[model samples]
Target: MIDTLWLIGIGTGSPAHVTMEGMQAIREASVILVPHKGAGKDDLASLRHGIIAAAGSTARIVPFDYPIRDPALPYLERVERWHDEIAARWQTALADVGVSGPVALLVWGDPSLYDSTIRIARRLTPQPTLRVVPGITAVQALTAAHGIPLNDVNGPIQITTGRRLRDHGWPIGATRLVVMLDGEASFQHLDEPDLLIWWGAYLGMPEQVLDHGPLADVATRIVAARQAARAQHGWIMDTYLLGRPQDAH
Candidate 1:
């Protein structure tokens, strides 16, 4: 049984985003688990390796084939089974390497934000003693990349997934929103007239890209850029802020 599993957030594929605490965890780890997301997304695993190396960590690196969530099942059920399989994979990796405690799994972005690492860890048999080193979140990275404030004055800023935005439209009366995990440029589906968008892809990385303008003016451009970047990079991680402008709000 694993004694301790450190969930260290590396943040947005950048070595600079790793916190001091996260570096310490990497350095102290007996084994570091890295997940391979197959061919097109190999960079995701590479970033984790880079983080560990940048920290000068000499820990054993154990790479495992990440399980793909079954799309045939409903979303919730598919996610539950995927988590179970991942937890099982972690167990197998640990046993194969013959290490128990002081294992580290580098997480992208903050562990507490829209991440399932902790939830999956809970499913481990004889559950590990968990430690989390919080890293920067995409929300923070996106806002900083564009040099924009997350909210206007004391107004609320709601964070939701792209699917919700597509299925439910804008959150009622939400003047500011941060959209994450949107595979489809869901904003393109909205017919809102006065909305504005600040979008960023690969935030905080060398290949970072940003765009902002009146939604009507730049919607197509953003989609084109996103598609081209995905084609070039084989994958992309992006988030966008949608809101009404000063007078409109």
Candidate 2:
């Protein structure tokens, strides 16, 4: 049985984003689990390794193949099945490591955000003592990259997935919106004439890109840039903020 499980958030795509507490957890853990997302995604695994290296940690590093979700199934059902498979993979990795001391998993961005590491950890048999060291989130990175605030003065901001934005237009009562996990620039589907956008991709990385302007004017540019970035890098992580002008607040 595991003794302690540390969920360390490494922030979004930057080794420098790792907090001191997160580094300490990495140094102290007997085993560190890194998930490999297969070909063309080696940068993700390398980033985790780089974090460990920068921390000067000698902890045993274990790499395991990540499970791919079936695309045929409905979204929710596929995600549920995928999480189950991932948990099982984690268990197997732990067994292979044969460690009884504290174990750590390097998570991308803050676990409390749109991440599932915490939920998957709960499914483990004889769950270990859990510890979460929060790190910077994509929302924070995106805003920081563009040098803007997340919300207008005293206005409520809605954080949502691209699917939601695509399925339903902006929700009522949300004057500002931050969209994440959107492969499709759902902002193109919005009909809000006054809306402006601040978008960023690969934040904190050397290949970072940022854009902002009237939605109608810059939406096409953002989509073209996103497509080009994805083609160039084979993968991309991006987030965007949408809202009316600051004077409207």
Candidate 3:
């Protein structure tokens, strides 16, 4: 049985985004699992390394190849199988490191947000005592970068994925919606010019980009920019806030 599991949020690729509490957790960990998505995306693993280096954590570092999900499978099934594989990979990594005490995974953004680390963590047999250390989320970083509030005063905000927005459209009664982990630029699907979007990529990182405007006018630019950035970086982490103007509230 695993003793302890720490899912430490590392924010969106920024070392400064690492919280003091998260640093402490890392320093206290006996083993750390770093997932490598291969070259070009080496920055992902590097970010975790940077965090450890910054914190001066002497924890044993373990690297494992991340499992790629079958694109042909149905979405839910694909995700389920992917998480299972990740859990299995974690188990293997733990065994290879020969650790019996505290272990940790450095999560991008906040663990409780759109991240699936928690879901995969639950699949571990016998389960480890979980300790979560929160860090800055992409939504918070995006909103702050754009100088906009996440929600209208007392207004409800919906947080959803890109697939949901593309398939189901805007949610009712949601004046603001935060979109994360969008594989598709779902904003391009919106036909409404009244809807305004504040989009950011690599939030809290040095190469961060921010754009905002009516959806129709800026959709093309956002899509082209997203595609170009994804091509250049091999991977991209982005989030956006959609808002409809309210009556002077």
**22-61: candidate 1 lDDT, tens digit per residue:** 8888999989999998889987887788888888998999
Clash count list over all predictions = 0, 0, 0
Greater-TM-score candidate between 1 and 3: 1
lDDT of 3 at 232: 89
Please give the distance, in angstroms, between residue 2's alpha carbon in candidate 2 and its true position after superposition.
3.0
Where does candidate 2 clash, by residue pair? none
- Give per-model CA RMSD: 1.4, 1.3, 1.5
Better of 2 and 3 by lDDT: 2
Least well predicted 10-residue stretch by lDDT in candidate 1 = 240-249
Question: How would you encode candidate 2's per-residue C-alpha lDDT over 42-84 as one tens digit per residue?
Answer: 8989888999989888889888889999999999999999999
Tell me how candidate 2 scores on lDDT.
Answer: 0.89
Give each model a TM-score: 0.97, 0.96, 0.95
Per-model CA lDDT versus the true structure: 0.90, 0.89, 0.86
The alpha-carbon lDDT assigned to residue 48 of candidate 2 equals 89
Off by over 4 Å in 1: 247-249
